[model samples]
Target chain A: MNFLEEVILKEGQALSDQVLKVDSFLNHQIDPQVMQKVGQEFARLYRSEGITKVLTIESSGIAPSVMAGLELGVPVVFARKRKSLTQNGDLLTAKVYSFTKEEENEISVSKKWLKAGEKVLVIDDFLAHGEAALGLANLVEEAGAEVAGFGIVIEKSFQSGREKLLKKGYRVESLARVASLSNGSITFTRNGQEAWSL
Target chain B: MNFLEEVILKEGQALSDQVLKVDSFLNHQIDPQVMQKVGQEFARLYRSEGITKVLTIESSGIAPSVMAGLELGVPVVFARKRKSLTQNGDLLTAKVYSFTKEEENEISVSKKWLKAGEKVLVIDDFLAHGEAALGLANLVEEAGAEVAGFGIVIEKSFQSGREKLLKKGYRVESLARVASLSNGSITFTRNGQEAWSL
Candidate 1:
């Protein structure tokens, strides 16, 4: 198992078959060491892609994405989540629905930050319904930039998020692929084999 | 001049006498290099404080605080901003009024993340009217923890934020202290002297 999977198994709470709470180390309370290592992992994976910038949503995605940007020696641009439309007209906006929050927020990136023909690497903490990932990709495309790939921390392979992104022809790399979270137990896929339960 | 001040002069916008826009490097579009340096400076300033954790507000504060936590070998916890009180009754909440947005947000920290007698270094991107800093300190105190000090990225010294924090006996260290933003130019405080102007 990777370091991330080991950490998840040790501290992650399998709240339900659909919800996995990693508040202790990932989202609410952040483990900087874990984030640093995760950043290094992302840099290792996408170093050859000629990524110009790292894009992520605000709040949860900032930590890992900034660390990855630091490792890759690129700037990090976070899309701000606004409940309403901002007054700025020079913004690349997308509508992202949060399955956990059950709300749709307008995520926006400033036009001045992103340039045309730039290769952007998108990063996020989780991949569930892929709404956020799709929204981020939409913003990059709107800026006339290329979405190089996505670096996700956790992927619920049981969900259709990963499949949807793959079908869209975007390279998605998730460090921890969760196979199951049932009966308060967590399981992972081995060597990209989803059928290998636990 | 410090590196942060240099970057501010180069890329930051002096929107008005009171408003400084650092979206290009510090907030919306983050320069990972500058953030890394800022984190190191924060760690250097507070390394002797015996801080067990780094606490900051979400979104803008995550990048610098997480980097400082990594340098100090501690966990970084971010308080989540909610439009209203959350359903969880175990959170330590504080009321913060934003001058720029003209909104009152109740920032909450989970009770499980903080422990009694632990020293927390409060981190924030901007120290203005001191509402956010005081609210962060209130959250730490509510958890029975001690607020070791405040690590701020930018401080508008003309505002009452730093004075209030100091009056409350909190050590406030800002990497870049802005004395004025008048006439589309930015000035800084030199050697703790606020009289130095551009």
Candidate 2:
């Protein structure tokens, strides 16, 4: 988490009060070394939970989820944004609004991949309004799978994402929680604290 | 390579003449152990290239590229198909035609991530028509970077992807090359040889 926070502090570019661009090492361009460290942290956090699979959305979430899956020795399943020709008809689909793209899109996974009573840990790069996370959780429930928890690289605590997931009684663990972004400066929550500190 | 060939022989699903779905381990649902093996194989193949970075496109390509990057102790850079509002303006962009989607879409990478004179190895899940590979290659070249070679998990040699990349003078290495898919049977090309035998 320290490595990730450090990387964010060093390389993360804040576009607005809400969005932070980590293309250098987090999403677009990835740092495998740092990613491994983050994966180890996730594995340490949820190893005892008996996670059967790691679930994520396309594009950004794939790298971190792959690393976590490798560390946890589990399968990684990603929900595709667009329905491909290869995708089977039996799928669990959910429509989610993307604040970044300013549009709504559907994410789906084959019913064959997820089954009943499986434990799935949802992972992603960023958590803002929590639409993507909720959508993934909805898919897991649709498959009759258990939501072990949600793991995120960064969370904007100033937003209502954390509150929304917590309201649903889903445990959300974010490596770095940004309490506030004022005047282009990011303030992170104190380490190992339930409530974010500004 | 034998391991990969065995995997294809055992788990590959042939839908038609043009489609072979291995989403169980290669793309949609990723097997961590097998993915690690793939990373090791790629490391073995390109270890001597002094690869500074592993380049790939988003969604499917991120997993293998991350694995390969981890094995080789290098960073991975994935080109994103959709540009977020936070994305930096200075980017290397290329137009890619997706046969599956039946449309042309643009992929881009922030110029800040790819430095001039960096040695990059492009990795992908499938190489059907070589548009994605060529698009990635174009982005790397535009950034004044050196492409070490291209690594593909599966290449449909029956298609023109390999021929196209070869004509561009790229040294392409595929773990499993399907020489043909006929009558619901898939044939793999022999390893490390230009001449493919079913």
Interface root mean square deviation per prediction = 0.7, 1.0
Give the per-residue lDDT of model 2 (tens digit) for A117-171. Answer: 9999999998999999999999999999999999998999888888999999999
* Alpha-carbon TM-score of each model against the true structure: 0.96, 0.92
Per-candidate RMSD, Å: 2.9, 3.5
A81-195 in candidate 1: lDDT tens per residue?
9877957789989999888888889999999998899999999999998999999999999999999999999998789899999999999989899989999999987664432
TM-score of 2: 0.92
- DockQ per model, Cα: 0.88, 0.78
Native contacts, share recovered per candidate: 0.96, 0.91
lDDT of 2 by residue, B99-156 (tens): 9878888888889778899999999999999999999999999999999999998999
- Residue runs of model 1 more than 4 Å from their true location after superposition: A191-198, B191-198
Q: Which stretches of candidate 2 lie over 4 Å from their true place?
A: A83-88, A191-198, B82-89, B191-198
